[model samples]
Target: MDRLIDAIERTQNPSVVGLDPTEALVPAQVVASFADEVRDSVDTPEEAPAAQLAVAFYEFNRTIIDAVAGIVPAVKPQIAMYEALGPAGIDVYTMTCEYAAEQGLYVLADVKRGDIGSTAAAYAHMLTGVNAGASAEAGSAGAGAHDPWHVDAVTVNPYLGTDGITPFVDAAKTADKDLFVLVRTSNPSSSELQMLDLADGSKVYEHVADLVERWGADTIGEHGYSRVGAVVGATHPQEGRALRERMPRTFFLVPGYGAQGGTAADVRGMFDANGSGAIVNSSRGIIGAWRTSGRYRKDMSADDALALVFDTAREAATAMRDDLRAVL
Candidate 1:
């Protein structure tokens, strides 16, 4: 958590670009580049299309990382995007985590995993490579070039309660990594359950916040924040402000900025007075700028757009950085 905060302080930008690529969002050229062998199978068989899609997603992520690595402190790759392609997709997800770290950006695997017993432990190991084993070979390998699934942190779902979340918390402590538990998510439907009032007069999310503070008690870092963080959506400014007050030492991974209808003004409350404690994320607003915005959109082939995509993405990233700096 301290390292993440330090990176944000150094950059003076509490923003992270989300690498949530999909077939619709990826450039046609990238897909075509890897689809030659699989093209025939895509029309007849099913296996090849998934394989080709995994490669395309990887190539697309590589391009996005190259474009924004110089500007942002972190990159979050949603695991589902890669999982859509099956095992090949999962392999790309691992590769993406490794590649982003190689680019000197904090990799937050948004896996949202929650379970019980060994299953939960397995999720922690596979996602963050935390508490994998104590073998001399494993220790020597380290969390680097050899560790393909290494991530600085992971987002987890907390609905299953402490039994499911503790493994991740323990693993994060052991590995010097972090965990962002889902507290107040950005989706509109989140309120359906999260906002329900308890018999004690506290909201569900507020209760969750109290639990987060307890879970993170021992893992507070040099910055006076914990390795156990919370995912507070930027879309709910009032709730965000309340969460900040409730979890004073909890780092926040604020999503829903930009494309999700969250602006800099909406997320200002997530940060502390020192302008630290949180990292805001923007996905399509940065990655798919060329396709969404009138300023960058063009009717060109994916190959033609390829030349401009990185440049457009870099410009969008820079703009987002500037926007956050203006407020923070």
Candidate 2:
């Protein structure tokens, strides 16, 4: 946790590249490259589109990862996007996670997977390599007994309370992994439940944030960041500040910047006095830049699109870092 936090601080940026691919938002070149392969193998257009999109999506993700690995501290691949496409999609998701790790980038599997007891354990194992299935040299003597295909961390939902979070806690402690539990989300509709005030005057999410702080205490690292963290959307600046104060040692994963109407200023409060406690994520704004009509594509080739997106994202992230530094 300390190393990761140090990296973020040194970079002076918290932007985490998010791989949340949607078929419609993919570039024409990506779609075209795999269309023929999918067309020949599948019987229906719907199936063919998904098949082609999944292939292109993973390749695009690799390209983006290659472009931004050194600039960003982490990459969050949203699981729902891959799961929506089926088994082939899952293969791509696993490959992307492994590839990200190989590139020396921290992978935060944005699964938000939650359950109780045994089922939760299964989810923990799947995300963090606790009971990792197999290694390349699994049967070889002295070939390393434990599989190391684990992610640096994973995002989880805390709706079910402590029981729902114990497995993740165990996984983090046992494997030196990390967890980012959702306290307040960025979506417009999250307020429907999160903002509801209880009879005691505290909001539902306030209660959640309080528990997250306590849960993370046991996992606090030398740098003052806990292995257990919280996901607070950048969209709610005031609420994010409140949550930051409530969970001083908890690392924060802030989503909703860029395309979600959150500017660099919106997330500044989540950081500690040293500017090292949060990671801001932007998905569509960074990955789907090619879809911005013809303006951004005027002089750029498909191969250069990812690079251009990375350049723009890096600039935005840098500006945010500067903004925070000025305040801190």
The top-ranked prediction according to lDDT is 1
TM-score of 1: 0.91
For model 1, name the residue pairs that clash: none
Model 1 per-residue lDDT tens digits across residues 35-59? 6766664545678878888888887
TM-scores for all candidates: the values are 0.91, 0.86
Which runs in model 2 stand beyond 4 Å of their true positions? 37-46, 130-149, 293-328
Q: Encode model 2's per-residue lDDT on 24-54: one tens digit a residue.
A: 6666665676767778787777788778878
lDDT scores for all predictions?
0.84, 0.78
**Judged by TM-score, which candidate is best?**
1
Stretches off by above 4 angstroms in model 1 are 37-44, 127-146, 293-303
